[model samples]
Structure formats: structure tokens, C-alpha cells
Target: MDADLPPLTEALVQDVIYAWCSSAKHEITVPNCGAVWGPEADVVSVTRARLGHEFEIKVSRSDWLSELRQIRGDRRCAKWYRAHTLTNAKEEAKKTAGLAAKGSNCCGLVPPSYFWLVTAPGIVRDDELPAYAGLMEVVPYRHGIHQAHGYRVTETRPAPRLHRVKLLDNQLMAMARGVTLRYWQQRRKAA
Candidate 1:
């Protein structure tokens, strides 16, 4: 860590991700509970066209590895998770769907159309990311003089579209509800 840089926390990374998504013209940017994916996203953003983007924030390398393990399943053979190709991963998921139903940790469902992993600088390398996932890093500002006090989120690798379907009305509603609930919860906490 740079001496001038503050340590990255999950909340800080999440705030950076939310700001990044909002600046990208996401119509709806919310923290937590998209409810469209099998797992709750750290941050979820929706474009005006209703395309969904899910961001999973990790402050440490261990957390990142753990996430991959949970999604890819620990028992699967090397070819499955190591394949990296979306088609290959999907085929493996299909093969393991029964295993998932049998209480395995693997997630058989397709993720949001766009999936990203957000982390602090040096925590995840671009080459380490799975083919289907993108990488975003929160690093000290690299541009201009007399900079702001906070870090900026930069997309080191663009995530490929994993699913084609636009978010359905109910799914959008669920996200909206989550945002509303979070708002009140924060307000209450501040009180």
C-alpha cells in the first residue's frame, strides 16, 4: 500500500463501484440485493435499456478466491472451472445442476448480463480473472494535479455479456424495493 493511500475497505470499494456505475449512465444504481442473481450483488446497476450489471466487491485476495470456489464448485474437475470460456462454464454448470440441487455450493443459474469483480489495487490481477468476469480496481487517483482525497474505480478489463435478457419488471421492482428499504435502514441507523 502507498503511504499516502488509505487502506481499502469493502464499504469504500462499494462506494467507488456505485460511483463508477452511476457515471457510466446506469439509470438505476443501487447497493445490495438485486435479487436477480443467485447471490446478492455487492452493487447492482441497471442501464436505461434494463440491462443489469452486477458488481462483487472484494477487499482481499482470499475473498476473491473464495467467491470463485463457491460459484464454480469445489468438487468439479479442473477442466470445468479452468475452462474460462463462457460456453464451457455453462456446459459444466448444466452437468452440475443436479449436484447443485443436491446441496452443492455451485451456482447453476446464469449471472447478470454483465458481472464485475471490484477490488483494491494489487488484490486481483487482470490475468487472474475468469473470462466471463471483468475487473475493476480502486486505486489512488492517477490523473491531474491537486487531486481529490478519495480513490477512483477504473475498469481494467471489460466484462463480456453473459446473458441477453433485459431485466424483467418484477426483477426491477425487486431492486427498487431493496433500494428503498436500504434508504430507510440507513436513515434509521443515522438516527
Candidate 2:
């Protein structure tokens, strides 16, 4: 990490993602939506066409590796899906249970159509990423003589559509309601 760089935190990653998602024309974006999506989601977004995107922020290499070990089954990740789909079903199932039981973050969770991994620069490499997930990095940009003006999110690999189905109306409502509820909760805290 650069000595002058701000500490890489989930909040910084989420802010970068919000800017990136908005620039890409997404209509709705929310952070910390365990009620609407999985607890593993650092940020969730919905496009105007109703496609859902999930961003999981990883600030450290250990945290990133830990995440891969937690989310199991073909439903959540393309890499896991491919690996399992190629193996003996019974044997794979046995192994999956042991690995997946290590965490509850993504167990039995249905993934959004698009999934992304966001990190500070150099935390993860492009080849390490799963096939189903996109990669983005928070990088310093707009350099001045002394330092960068701020950080920006840049996609290293675009995420493939994991599924064609748009989010159902009910799911959209749940997301909307989740944001509304979060807003009020924050307001209440301020009061």
C-alpha cells in the first residue's frame, strides 16, 4: 500500500462502487442489504431494465480468499458451478457440505444476475477471479503534482450475465423497502 494512500475500507469501496454503478446508468444502489440480498453483499444495485447486480468488497487478500471458501454450489458462483458440475455429484456434495458449513454468509443464497468483486489495487489479480464474477479496483486518479485528487472504481474485467431473468417485482420492492428502512433508521439515529 502507498504510504500516502487513504486506508482501504468498505466505506471507500462502496462509495467508489456507487459512482461506478451510477455512471453505468444503474437506477438504484444500496449498501448493507442483508434483508434484501445476502449478508455477503457489500453493495446491491438494480438497473432500469430490472437486472440486479451484487458487489462484494474485499479489502484484504485473506478476506477475499475466505469469501471464495464460503459461498458454495452452482447457484452462487460460476467457478464453483463449473467445478462441481464436472465432478462426481455424490462426492462433490459431501465436500461441499464441509466447506460451505464453515460460513453462513452465502449459504442457500440465490445470486443476482451479475456479481462483482471490488478491491483496492493489487489485493487480487485478474486470473484469481471466478468466471462468474467481475473485478474492479479502487485506484487513485486525477493526479496532481503532490497526489491524486481522489479514488475511482475501474473495472478490470466485466462480469458476465449469470442469468437472463430480471429481478421479480417483489424482489425489487424488497430492495426499495430495504433502502427506505435504512434511511429512516439512520435518521432515527441522528435524532
Off by over 4 Å in 1: 76-110, 142-149
List model 1 lDDT by residue over 1-191, tens digit each: 57777788877777777667666788987776746554466788889877778887889889877766755675655324433434353454344444555776643443367878888777776667787888887778756432234778777888887756566555677788898898899899999
Which parts of model 2 are misplaced by more than 4 Å?
71-110, 143-149
What is the clash count for each candidate, in the order shown? 0, 0
lDDT string for model 2 (52-98, tens) is 78888999989877666644533557445533432333343344444
Model 2 scores a TM of 0.73
- Considering summed lDDT, which 10 consecutive residues are worst modelled in model 1? 78-87
Report lDDT (CA) for all predictions. Answer: 0.69, 0.69
